[model samples]
Target: MINAKEAFLKASTELKENGIENSTYEVREIFKELLKLNPFDIDFAQKELSQSQEDLLNDAVNRRKMHEPLQYILKKWEFMSLDFNVRSGVLIPRQDTETLVECALEVVKQNNFTQCADLCTGSGCIGISLCHYSKGLFTQGYDISDAAIELATENAFLNSCDRFIAKKHDVLLSAIGKYDIIVSNPPYIKTQVISSLQSEVKDYEPHLALDGGESGYEFYKAIIPLWKNALNKGGYMCFECGEGQAEEIVKLFEVNGFSQIRTFKDYNKIDRVISAKLL
Candidate 1:
């Protein structure tokens, strides 16, 4: 018979004890999710939770207490101010990737690109956000994981991105269609270091979306030259990379005959994105 305030406090305390940095925020989000209330629905936070809601909240809280990602527990994530359906097998859309999206947006708009392709497009956040912002631009997003492809497709519809298409594909193996813009937030974590990551990433997030081979540049190495065949001359290629990786990634693009290479920082001032043109 727990009330809303009690439930919030209990969940907050549990998360805090487990070292969750944003316990209060997570508790409110979890409460909102379990109650099917809006994020600002403070009134719901004042009411008593029914038995079923309480059970569901406890189960969700338990998952978070076990280091499950809050987004996964909630089954949705926000990116580019757009909602995306996320699940266990697919990588969650993150705010950091929005840096890449911002850069891609600029390139696409400046070039008035009509076609774009997203490789390793988990959840279709990049491609869908691009399409949502620029209606009528044709975009295709590819993911190696079928689960990710499905999730991306659902997000495309949920966000009314009619021009976005998703398909199961291994970016490491083959290149897709040519385009005026290409973007990706491919796996960038070093393979050997994945196990040392936070439990939320190491245990919960799919490894196929995290492991980037011995040097964390395996995907870039594979895509830089091969994907060139999929790009129009003077078209843009953008990427979201790990911290301190943008410089090296620029060199990779240079070797692949890309120029006008530039990097951008995120809100935290981390060098998180790189954009280049194939000339």
Candidate 2:
């Protein structure tokens, strides 16, 4: 008997009580996803939700109340204004990482680079975005998780980035082929501090994409040396880092024979991306 707007308002209140920051946005998204209709389309004020749709709404609200991510619930997200498929077990693309992509684009354009290796590519956001922003750029993305690889591949196809390829490989174990650029947003959250993060991250997001080992630099330490062989002379390397970790990652790039090391902050002004060039 409840109307659509009434149901949404109730769900939003519940979400607010649960401390979800994007409660209002989540409600609109859920309506679009579950009901095949946008809440704001055609003035939902007078439209009553069907019984089945109401049940679906309740389920979505409860899931969010339990700290599940809205992206996972919607099964889609946007990166750099491009749509990407999202699901559990694969890392969701964060807007902060867009700073890394933007910075890398400058290097790619400066060198007229046409090929890139995206290590630890989750959902192929970085690699796919590069190919999108620059025509003729080919991209290869690698990840250890089968789910991540599969999702990344699907995203490449979804975005019509035919030159993008995703493979299953751990950056810590081996290196990709030489490319004009290499980018990664590897797990950088410290092993110990992961548990203290927000429930949306600690409880819902994949730990394999967040844990950075004892010093929050295990992947960086392991991949820098290994990736050295895959980077061509004068090629660029870039990374998305946790707050305050860019300095250490720049030092790692320096240790591995990279120069012109620089860092870029996200909109939040947190040190988020670091870049360097191979000497």
lDDT for each of the candidates? 0.88, 0.90
- Compared with the true structure, the alpha-carbon lDDT of candidate 1 equals 0.88
Q: Model 1, range 48-87, lDDT digits (tens) per residue?
A: 8888988888898888899999999888877888778889
Where model 2 places Cα greater than 4 Å from the true spot, the runs are none
Q: Look at candidate 1 and give me any clashing residue pairs.
A: none
lDDT of model 2 at position 167: 91
In candidate 1, how many Å is residue 87 off?
Answer: 0.4
User: Can you give the lDDT of residue 147 in candidate 2?
Assistant: 95
Q: lDDT by residue for model 2 over 42-108, one digit each (tens)?
A: 7778889998998888888999899999989889998999999999999889899899899999999
